[model samples]
Structures are given as structure tokens and as C-alpha cells.
Target: MSFLAPIPLPAPLTTRALNALRRDIVTTRLAPGETLSEATTAERLNLGKAPIRAALAQLAAEGLVQPVPRRGWIVSLVTVRDIHEVFDLRLLLEPEAARRAAASAQDRAAAAAPERLDAVCRAGYRPEDPASALGFLEANRAFHVAVAELSGNARLARQIGRLLDESTRMLVLGLRRRDRSGEMAHEHRALTAALAAGDAAGAAALMREQVAASRAMVLAALTVPDAATVA
Candidate 1:
């Protein structure tokens, strides 16, 4: 007879709890501003209260959750102002990053940037399938971050990754409000071609246009009276 392996401790348990909560929030399953009840979360996730609390604290630090004075934790709400701020930061960095990535992609003969982006564009999204919304968001985020990484700038890539995380939530909400997946995939294909061809200026311009359009869509969605219900 063999002895049973020891169960993992709270640190690892908290990490698993954190990832579950984060996925729910990012995928809109938790919904913006939904109160997080510890008991309910623990019961639903089959986790202990200790790990849930630890996960909430970490999520709050990431701006994905907010702690109320006397109530409990709530999923952070995205506002029009938040959209503007996030896109403003992206606009400042992404265009330049794309230009650099174009040059880098040209020098690396075996670069997979074009192929990776193409795969995402080809996969596209199905408006009728609700699950496709998350797939679209993940693909979109991967394409952007991959472009940034191809720039050969670690700091720039890290910054873009963080911005993309915040942008994913807005994009998911926008997709629910309006089906722009086809248009977005088309734009990604064009941008990928420009990068592969080393057209730095064209790539930069395309990236700017893409970010601006996404920002406009999200802002417009937030302005609707039933925006909350739509998502």
C-alpha cells in the first residue's frame, strides 16, 4: 500500500481561485459591477473561503474587482472614461510598436508573425454562437500582443499586454452590442500583410485606425441606454 500524496497548500489554491474569478469577469459571465459574495463564490467554485478572499484581494489590485466599504467585492465596471483612457494609452504606443514590428518582421526571414495573425483572421467569429465571442476576444488579443512582441521590445510588449487585458473586456462588451468581428478580422489581415512586407508607415497607420475604430465602438456601446443589459 502506498501513502496518499499531500494536498497542495493555500497559495496554489488561491491561484486557482484567482484564475477562475478572472475568467468569469473577463468573459462577462460575472458581469460588470456584480457583487461577489464569498459564500456564493466558494460554493459555486468549490473553493474554501480563505482562498476566495485571497483571490479577491489580488483581483482588486488588478482593477478587475473593487471592494465596497461595507458590502463586498464587485466586478469593476468599465465606463466611457475608462475606454478613452485605455485607448489613449494604446494610441500612444501601438502605432510605433507596429512600425518597429514591421521592420523586425522583414529582417527575420523565418518570422511566424504573418502566419500566426493569418490563422486568427481565418478563424473569424460566428455571431450566432455566444461562445465565439470569447474566442474572438482571445484571438484579437493574441494578434495584438504578438505584433507587439515582434517589435523586439520587451517593455513595449509588456505594456501592450496589460493594455490588451483591459481592452479585452471592452471588446467583448462591444461584440455583444454589435457584431464587428468580420470587419475586425479583415483589418487584422491587412495589417498583418503590411507588417510582413515591412511597410512600416502603412502598418503604423493601420494600427492607429484599428485602435481608433475599436475605441469608438466601445464608447458608442457605453452610451446606449440599455448598454448594461446588452452585455
Candidate 2:
């Protein structure tokens, strides 16, 4: 008689696990203030504790999770102060980067920047469509990152990349309320026009206003939840 045998498990865990966990934390699917235990996660994920621990550490680095000394990890809480400060810093730095990009970008990248930024604006605020909203957000992120790259500043771009990660989380939260995608797109077009004209000052000024406008809109939503639908 042939005996039935159990099927072996899939594959060994690796960085994919870490990345998946990080995405969940950022997207708030895991929820804020929720504690995560390596053993528990390992069991649920059908993996070992080592991989889970390592993933938790990676999440900690991203500020999506906090290590609690002897305790496990807790999901990072979203605070109004954090939201204000993160966007404020973005406002301070990104405009300068945009100016540098506009000043130096002379070929395909120059043309591409404006087009990409315009696309981001057209994406608008899409509350009912989370994936669509994220697409617009990613496009917006690429626009800023493109500016930093065009500026030819590796160090600045790296720092800005880190800031963008944190800012993205806040943005996803804000998206739950309304869609600022259209206004955002308009600002991008204006900035692009300034860039196309090689007006560094004009590009920078417009970028500053654009960033401030985004921050204010997001902050307004956070303060008044009832006003979530307002853009």
C-alpha cells in the first residue's frame, strides 16, 4: 500500500519577508501601536524566529516600528507633530533641489521632469481608489527624486530618499480623506513651465508654494477628520 505523504513547505525566508512586513507597516494594515512578536509572526508566516527578528529590525530602521527594550516591537504611531514636521522639512529642502535640477537639466531628463510632474498633478486625490492614489503618490515621489538626481547631488538625494519614505506614509494617511491630486498636478505644471524656461528662481519659488500647499491640505485633513472629503 502506498502511504500518503505531507507536502514539503515552500521556500526559506529572506529579505522578501522583511520588505513585506515593512510595506504592511507603512500602509497601516498592521495598525499603529500594535505589538509584534517574532515568535508569533514566525508561526503565522510559517517561518523561523530569526527571519522575523531580522525583519522587525529592518522595520525599526525605517521608523515604522519601534523596539521596546525587553518587549517586542510596536507599530509607530502617527502624530500630528510628525506629519507637520516631516512635510515642513520637505518644503524646506525639495524646492532647492528643484531649482538645482531646473538649472542643470538640459536634455531628456529636463523634458521628462516636467512631463512626469504634470502626470502627478493629473493623478489628483483618489480616495476611492487606493492603488490609483498610491500610483499618483509614487509619481510625485519620482518627480522629487528626479529633481535631486538632476541636481547631481548624491548625498542630498540619499537624504531626501529617506525623508520621502517617511513622507509617503503620511501621504497615504492623508489620502484616506480627499484627493489633492489635481491641485498637486497644477502646481507641477507651473513648476515645469518655470523649469522649461530655465528660470531657476521661478522654478524654486513655484516649488516652494506647491510644497506648502500640499502640506496645508494634508494638515487640514488631519486636524478636522469630518472635513476629510474637502480638498
Candidate 3:
């Protein structure tokens, strides 16, 4: 008989549960305003009630979910105002970042800068596969972060990182319709080429156009009638 020592159990349940809930909620799989019950989540995940409760509490802290007075936890609803705020920040930050990336490419001092935008465009084009969206989001972040990092301002980079997180979070929430993903990818590719070619003015112009288009999309999503709102 092979003697086997008792397998050590993994870390505590609550952390595992919290991560699972956060992943599903952030990815839009749970959908905005979707109510979550501890019992149902626990059963569905094969986790204990204690863990599920703990997880929901943490998600509430992240503003991804909220507790109702009498109902239960529901996905947080992002308002039109929220969309405006996110895009407003994007408009303020990204244009300048793109300019810097273009300058860096022109000088040939920033080897990684050019590829950053390329990677983001590549990832965005992979949106047809839902499993790839997370990677796309990560690459998108890396692109913005690269530009900021090459700006030679640590504070600016950190600020850009925080703002980009908020913007991407809202974008991910609103990107429920994958029909237009190809169009978005093309826009990104154009922006990338402008940056890589060391065309500062062109990159800045493209960045402005991209943000403006994004703002329009968000407004339309907020106001236009959709089956998503029919419930």
C-alpha cells in the first residue's frame, strides 16, 4: 500500500469565493443590476454559505455590487453620468500620452513604446472569443501604461493608471454588444500606426477622435432602447 500523507487544503474559502465573484461580475457575465443571493451563489459555485457571504461583502466594497435594504446583493448600475466622467478623464489623459508615445518612437529612445499600441490593437481584434477579452483588456492597459511610463513622470503614470482602470471598467461593462468590436479594433490599429510612425500630431488627432467616438457610443448605449433594458 502506498502511504499518502493528507493533502494540505488550499487557503481559506472566503478569498477564493471573493475572486470568483469579482471575476464574473467584472466581466459582465453577471450583468449590471443582476441580483445575487448567497444561497444561490454558494450552490452554483459549490462553495459554503459563509464564503459566499464574505465574497459578496468584498465585491460591495469594490463598488461592483451593492446591498439592498430588503432585497440582496445586486450588480452596481453605472449611470450615464458615470460614463461621461470616465470618458472625460480618458479624453484628458490619453491624447497627451499618445503624443509622448509618438515623440518617443520618433527619437527611437523608447523601444517598447511602439509595440505597446500594436499589442493593444492585436488583442482588441480577438474579441470574438469571449475568453480572450480579459487578455485584450490587459494589453489595452499595458499600452496606456507604456505611454505614461515613457513620459518620464512617475506621478502622471500613476494617475493615468488609476484613470485607465476606471475607464476600462466602464468600457467592459458597456461592451455587451460584440457586433461592433471589429470596428473598434480597426480604430485601435489606426491609432497604433500613427504612434508607431512617430507622427505626434497624427497620433494626438487619432486619440482625440477615438475618445470622442467612445463618448458617443456610451451616450447611445445609455439612451437608446435595448433589450438589455427591457427586463
Candidate maximizing TM-score: 1
Q: Which should have the higher lDDT, number 1 or number 3?
A: 1
Model 3 RMSD vs true structure: 8.1
lDDT of 3 by residue, 1-231 (tens): 346867755448988998788767656678777888888899999999988987888778767789987687888776776678778887888788778767777566657655665665576434456666666666666766876776566777888887665556555644544334566667778877887777888988887887787667656665556523321
Model 1 Cα shift for residue 85 (angstroms): 0.5
Count of backbone clashes, every candidate in sequence: 0, 5, 0
Name the lDDT of candidate 1. 0.87
- Off by more than 4 A, model 1: 1-10, 229-231
lDDT of 3 at 176: 49
Off by over 4 Å in 3: 1-18, 43-55, 106-110, 124-142, 152-178, 227-231
- Candidate 3's displacement at residue 64, Å, is 1.9
After best superposition, candidate 1 residue 133: deviation in angstroms? 0.6
lDDT per residue, candidate 1, 117-141, as tens digits?
7886666678889898898888898
**CA lDDT of each candidate?**
0.87, 0.73, 0.71
TM, every model? 0.90, 0.78, 0.70
Q: Considering TM-score, which of the candidate structures 2 and 3 is the better prediction for this target?
A: 2
| Residue pairs in clash, model 2 | 121-185, 124-181, 124-182, 125-179, 125-181
Query: Against the true structure, candidate 2 has what lDDT?
Result: 0.73
Give the candidate order by descending lDDT.
1, 2, 3
